[model samples]
Target: MELAVRAPTSATVDDVEDVLEKKKQWILETLYGLVEQDDPPLDKEYLSSEKLLYNGRRYRLRVEESSVIEPELIFDGNRFDLLVPENDAINTRRKRQAVVDWYVTEATQKLPKRADDYIQKLGIDDIEIEVTTLQRRWGEYRPGHVSLHSRLILAPRKIQDYVVAHELAHFRHEEHSDAFWNTVGTLVPDYRERREWLRVKGSTLTV
Candidate 1:
């Protein structure tokens, strides 16, 4: 099987490589299981026939091979028209990277804004927001910063919003204590449902 590591900018190559080394067995096992089950709808293969999710909407990818200068992605609410260089069109790994790059760009632009809004509502102004790659978590929070996963861009807006609030709530309590959960509930009344949704479908959302 093929393996690719799209790590956070702050991570060094060595650090990413170390993580991959540690998780190689787990990764191989997961991939084998997914392959056996035929996988969820969108397995991030980046094939033209695969379905993609954007803000809770399902879209099928339609690749238009062209002898153009660069790859281009266009979404007209129904489908993703990915115009790729003829050479890149047939390269599955390259196509996957292109689609993931688009998702990262969108996440960088939109996720931070959503987090900022939640930060304001939480009345916390000292926290910094950054879009990064997190393989095992949707968002991670520290004393002064929060790193949101770029993969979140594919989920619905409400789910994304819930994650922001959940992270922001961390500032009030370091652990997932009752107080911290209360803070999240105050910010998002239906957070339980959102958490449930993530528990059920989060595994299928991968790069």
Candidate 2:
């Protein structure tokens, strides 16, 4: 990533110096245009373009230009990575299984083996971990199981740990009630701030 800096100029008008404020804006616009032209177009046809591991299961990506307004994952017998166009609401559902399957293998190698340890510390048990891609939630704890979005791999390590701890707390308390929060606090005292940070910056995780 390159940044363009513009020098300010001074011009006297009515004994007042006119600062060249617009130069900075112009330079930034020029840099953005150049970057756009130089960057390669986003390949929307390659399925399994990127891989991520949540828990232990490997997920393959499927990219397509569809009418769906938002990017989403489809699990229709097989996982499908779906990318929709904002303007071109096309119905193209091209499927690519594993163009880059190595990503899953690599990501799995990076996952922690003792993912449930943190929850166990809080006296919770009988919870399973599942890795998936969810647009809105980072982690969820259902009855006897927990689903963690594979996108969490994009988050910082501390934040990811916070998410894990949060879900684990749910095993004891199902809702976001006071009891649930107190349980989370026992594991991660600053979980609220980390949760807020993930909410605000979650979009940055996507490629």
Candidate 3:
């Protein structure tokens, strides 16, 4: 097997190899899983022809360079029409930033209400709902606030609910003990399946 590793420019060759050696088994398993995957991996290129999943439905992307200074995203029940400034059309970083800004705006509008419903159902008070550009986890709960990965808006509603419930459960139990799982199960009866879906497809939930 051929493995290509990219690390910080400052890192030594031994440092890179040591890290790869430590996670060799995991890397192999991930590669095997990619090979076995039936569905085409979600596009991370953020290009015009890319297919994007939003709220459980697929939307084809259409990028239009417009005179408008601010980027705008419109979904016409069929696909996403992204109107961007002409300068942003060819710049990957600017284009990605525009798309991510839209996603973050969407999550800010939708997720808090959904979280509020669960919070009310669980009788949890004084819970602050916020969106974050989280790289490692879906969501996390602190003493009085829950921070969700903003990109979760790309996932289906049920999956989003599972994440919200999972964090809320943390409000009661700080650790993932039986009591914690049971609490999560009580709120989301089919959580096991939902979690499995995230495990399989979550990596593709990128913008």
lDDT of each: 0.77, 0.55, 0.77
> Against the correct fold, how does model 3 do in TM-score?
0.74
Candidate 3: tens digits of C-alpha lDDT, residues 1-207: 346788999999899989987886576335322222245464466668877678877789998889878777777879888787876545667666777877889899998777776787788898888998765578877889899888789889999998899889888988666898899898999987887777677777767
Work out the TM-score per prediction.
0.75, 0.49, 0.74
Which of the numbered candidates is closest to the native, going by highest TM-score? 1
lDDT of 2 by residue, 1-207 (tens): 344434434534522323334354444233212122223324445444565333224457566666665454554434645554556644434222232232334334443333656855866566667776554567666887767766566567777787778777777777666798798788888876776656555555543
Candidate 1 per-residue lDDT, tens place, 1-207, comes to: 245678889999899989987886576335312222224554465657877788877799888888766666778878998778875535667677677888899999999898766777778787789999975678878898998988888889998998889889988888666788799999899987887677667766665
Candidate 3 lDDT (Cα, 0 to 1): 0.77
What is the number of backbone collisions in each predicted candidate, taken in the order shown? 0, 2, 0
